[model samples]
Target chain A: MSILIDRNSKVLVQGITGRQGGFHARLMMEYGTNVVGGVTPGKGGEWFDGKPVFDTMRAAVKTKYADVSLVTVPARFAADAIMEAADAGIKLVICLTEHIPVADMMRVLAFCRQRGTRLIGPNCPGVMTPGEAKVGIIPAMVALPGDVGVVSKSGTLTYEVGFAMKNRGIGNSTIVGIGGDPVIGTTFVDILEMFENDPDTKKVALLGEIGGSAEIAAADYIKTSMTKPVAAFIAGRSAPPGKRMGHAGAIVDGGEGSADEKIQALEAAGARVAANPEEIPDLLS
Target chain B: MKLHEYQSKALFQEYGIPIPQGRVAETSREAGAIAAELGGTVVVKAQVHVGGRGKAGGVKVARDAAAAERHAQAILGMNIKGLTVEKVLIDEAADIQQEIYLAITNDRSAGQPLLMTSMQGGMDIEELNRTRPDAIIREHIDPILGLQPYQMTYIASAMRLPRAHWRSFLKILSGLYACYNKSDAELAEINPLVITGAGALLAVDGKVIIDDNALYRQPALTAQRDSSDEPESERLAREAGITYIKLEGQIGCMVNGAGLAMTTMDMTKLYGEAHGIGPANFLDIGGGATPEQVATALSIILSDANVKAVLFNIFGGITRCDEVARGILTAYNAVQPEVPMVIRLQGTNAAEGKKIISEAQLPHLISAETLTEAAQRAVAAVQESA
Candidate 1:
């Protein structure tokens, strides 16, 4: 029981002709994702990598019965793309694009909340269930089906945690990157709720970074709703103030979003904090 | 992007918020002329993207044109902390009978926009919150509803505003929110939203920081950036389309994996500061970084003036170790860096990749056993360079 995706989920690729979409589609197919079709307007009736192309999501979903869509369109068109996906009745959507305008996500998130569309990311590495289904850009080969369900905002850190889990022979049920954007579609709390209910997931390793109060909010949620054992690592412990580490949401404004504050909040909420990357493996045990 | 008071006030004016008449002047002569044109006393304040300017000798209240000119001369030419005082804002002085503060910023902890107002102003809000929490009022604004008129009215009335100034305060409060939303700001603050003795609400000082991710949509805000204040290496890295963050580590890191790159830095620190190398930088070439991109990342890492040794810690999954080895060899041939290098390649094609790197036989290129070994070798190389 992967939290969000499994082998039976049929997937459609938005902007299937784009470079990023084409590249990751091949990887997903190789990883055995049930990639049913591709969608790019004006490119209907064409094919790429053995997948049929349709002009609209509604047409592709109607013909192939696609239940999932991987969105790779630009930020300006992402909201419309999501709405189209919702109208087509795709239950799960993964947004692989980065730097989506917050206003666009604002409308998209509000719509998804009302319409019951589950979003995995807008700037994330996607979700993967080992030996089952994969969506997004996560390296499928490194993952294995196991008890730990991983979720993170940082891709590199997710890779680190996954590699550590692998080194310890502790497999992962699902690893979903909620993304590093301020207005991310999925939160740790959302994914934590899913993981808590999943029989396959006995534990969760959450990797967060400096910036934003998502960690603190997640802490509050974890205090009550979480049932699985949770281990977390918040990077940027020694990272200087004021400079954005990289992502737009990584700004250390007014000392509120510093790693120290996040660590304190998480510790208070009963999370075992991995102070650094090397310490993460120890926390997992 | 942080705008000075004058710029933010200009933005405030556009949103119909009432601000005192002000002009930014670069020189004392311009300041004197502006003060003279204003007909009387004016306040001269330095323009910097930081707070505590009043305590830092950057703000002065002058009685007349001569006093305003002197204060402007003192502020314009002086340096506050590390930032140069290049401009002074000249504005008509307000008779501040009461100082109230207001701001709107994303409170990540609350997972929404936060609206903070205080009867206590012109002081450290944090200290005030700790010492006298009741002096301030905080509200978590719903992202969907925003700060509605009724909420603003409630806060304004609770602050005990005079009946004469209530309408104006309401207008200014709405306008502030408009400015906050219009700029896509992460932070918008007015420290001294004063009620003048003459009973007029005045926004004396204000600041706004537009979100960097929203920069593509905010061309004016992006263009207002001062590149001079940025690190040279960081600027060059940005131009090259590489994600590089300068650090204090002695071992300069050029890695294909961002996660491994960070772990490399952490493990390097674990080995101790024998060479006092702060994290030289955080470079993420992203997944599927090509040999050319790898080579470019190498060149950028080597280009840092403080870098004495360069460490390549790559864990191949999607990024094949052989391709990363090829990149190192290519960058080595191109840049011909004289400093030492430690290469830690694992995962795909590790054996073949070792053979390829060893074949190059570059003088400074050293292969290590583990991340620990690589960090030690890099630190030793830095000492040798020193």
Candidate 2:
């Protein structure tokens, strides 16, 4: 079975009445995600997409039995929303809101950890288990049901790799976007562990960008713990030092985090590092 | 968002961390007046975001007011690591007995705020860490628990700080941590936290990088943003809601998504390697971008004179290809860029987007179905033009 989300997962959409929340919630529903209800603080007792709206996550969780939550609140309130979701007993918290303060996220992670909740992404595309459920912003068209589990720190790049894999007639078991934030809820090793345990997943594709030692840690983990064959592609190889390449986390600092270092680490760990995004599927095959 | 030394010192003062008495000066005459006010013996430090200001001669010690003016005059317009020194901080020079390093930064791996201190101060911490790792003492502060008093004491004792200075050192540590926490700073550093000849602990140099994500709440710090040190194009891109970074190559790239934008830049560089051409800039139009934003992004790319050719790689998910096409057409009509352009539109409504561009039949516009083809074409066009 696919990891994280499946057809049976009851999802609650936080900030479901907002523009981004409403837009992506509809897309998630269209892809057959088991979205039970919506949560908007003041807009409670309203209805969105024929689902009941609640003021608090506790009400949403209690009334609708929502096991998972997709937080689409604005950056200012995102950390609080995540903490609320965890405190309200949502097992899997998926935050789509980006740019929450680093300190706020650190506290949120601590809060979530104490509550035994698994949080994924504050700036991530969310997760998609092909042919089962769609939880976040990952497009439904690009994914096909199969065995290659995909995890990335990027959105469109994951879509590109997924589309290539789909074209190569190799579908995905699950796709998790852990986000490219300097501080995120989850890490590469966290998702890789799930992919390894999932029987439906035979191989994994990891899409990484420059910045952070997570890739190096992942490489170490892959070398020691992972048994499944993993193919990886890292972006920002051509990026210059000390420049942030769009993503907040994608920056080279003191020559620590570079694509070359990551690629070398992954290669040394027995993982095939693809030259580009399109070569990912070929590497996996 | 990196705050200049003077700015960081101002913030440090607010938090009760002692800094050398100083005032920012834009003119050499102002610097002279400030130095005279501070009893003539002053340090003129250039205000710029880049590091190694000391090595660049952006920092100078003046024995008198006249020397302060000369130093400020030499520094104000001087280029330090590609950044111009527009202002200098004139401060009363400190009599250093010893130097210490202290900082509070986010430890991404631990998911906590990391407090680092070293006796080997006034030097590159990274270089020090690489060379003598044990010389640096680190403490992880729980976001909820914060920097405990014991943690600070442990660090002070570990560094063999004198018992007499421990009390003041602890205050400085707590003050710095408080400033870091309250300001939502990614990094709050006091490099060379000097013990003065008078036995007073003072923050001789300060650096604070406010978390950009938290800037919404920090209106004061946001107002202090010095655009002079950064490229004008970057500032424009930020205002336009585009994430842009200027490069030294010729192929300008506009793509949706940060990862894809970087990859597009890499691919462009890879293909252009043989031709000695590469991406001139990294521009991410971002997801769900409107036509106006896309047009603005295009304008920013075109604004870079080094750009010989422009590449548009849009893999539409939340960002629709049709919207991108409309924006392209809008920019094409508005800017009338003379550079050859290549467009690759895939994912949602790719065909519709391609059809829209082809139907427009804009002059010097080319299309590719794949990223590889688009990069190849973009590089080839730049090479051909060169």
Which one is best on DockQ? Answer: 2
Candidate 2 local lDDT, residue A166:
89
* Candidate 2 chain B lDDT trough over 10 residues, lowest sum: B286-295
What DockQ does model 2 achieve? 0.82
In order, what fnat does every candidate score? 0.20, 0.73
lDDT per residue for candidate 2 within B323-377, as digits (tens), equals 7888889878887889999999999888899999999988889999888899999
Enumerate the candidates' DockQ scores in order.
0.38, 0.82
Model 1 global lDDT (CA atoms, 0 to 1) = 0.79
TM per candidate = 0.92, 0.98
| Weakest lDDT window of 10 consecutive positions for candidate 1 chain B | B255-264
Regions more than 4 Å wrong, model 2: none
Error of 1 at B206 (Å): 1.3
Query: Which pairs clash inside model 2?
Result: none
- Candidate 1 local lDDT, B1-386, one digit each (tens): 67778888888888888789889899999999999998677899998877778899999998888999999988986878677888899999998999888888766444466788888886766777777788787777666667788888888778776678789988888888888887888778887889899888888888888766678888987877766556677887787777788876666787654444555666566564544665678787766676677677777787777777888877776677788788778878877888888898766577788999998877988998556678778877777777
Q: B229, model 1: CA deviation in Å?
A: 1.4
Candidate 2's displacement at residue B334, Å, is 2.4
